[model samples]
Target: MREVTLTHRECVKLIGSPERARYGMVSVDGREPRRLTCLIVGDGDLLIDLDRERPIERPIAGRPIAVEFTHHDQRGNGGWTVTGLGLARPIRDGDKPIPMPYTTLTVGAFETGVRVCIARLTGRRTRPTQI
Candidate 1:
């Protein structure tokens, strides 16, 4: 029997479009299997997607992700931010949590290949008068 291969590029394609319901699976050396049905649009600006089958449930769902990030903003004040992104699911085991902005998860074909980063959600800087 051949195993199903899900690549990072495939996940990226799913994120590019505006739709709902994608089928995939997550696997690891010693752990339970997880299935993912990522909904890209809906649930506000944030992308609603996750693998619910994890033994330990995480509150990652409904979390916001940065689609387009900007460093600065207009009037040289606060930056324009947009939070909402969708991507592949994470695969790992053992109850452990780190206090970092992002989590490096073991996923897909590469070792240390999958990175769940909390990117900055900022828009391009514009002059206040433009607003």
Candidate 2:
């Protein structure tokens, strides 16, 4: 099994698009549970670093989201689920979108069904990486 580990910063960079959500392709099976890139926006423990030079929203210091991505395979369909702590209400820190805590997201069809989760981490910290 191959695992794509993304740091907190990596997640934010992927979330650069302003469409609320975006479409990222990866070399994986086009079946249910295919790994893909996504942005989980909610009232989760994640935070938006709208203060950065590029200003990318990233997962907070403690919340790390588990992105289970999948696509259509011969057996069934395709989709992805980002599970973690999320928001309970709309989080707007200034003009940017701030995710809440404790939520689950499921995205599919490359555009049709997009799900974003929000979660909080107790004390998890991931180093930022350049995409």
Q: What's the lDDT for all of these models?
A: 0.30, 0.31
The digit string of per-residue lDDT tens for model 1 on 75-119 reads 455433223233323324311123211323222222212223333
In terms of lDDT, the poorest run of 10 residues in model 2 is: 47-56
Q: Write the per-residue lDDT of candidate 2 for residues 1-131, one digit (tens) a residue.
A: 22345444444433432333433322111222323434434332222222221222333222223333222234433222222333322234332333322224433222121223343222222233334
Sequence-dependent TM-score of model 1: 0.23
In candidate 1, which residue ranges exceed 4 Å CA deviation? 1-11, 14-20, 27-30, 40-56, 59-131
Top-scoring candidate (TM-score):
2
Each prediction's TM-score versus the true structure: 0.23, 0.26
TM-score of 2: 0.26
Q: Output the lDDT of residue 91, model 1.
A: 27
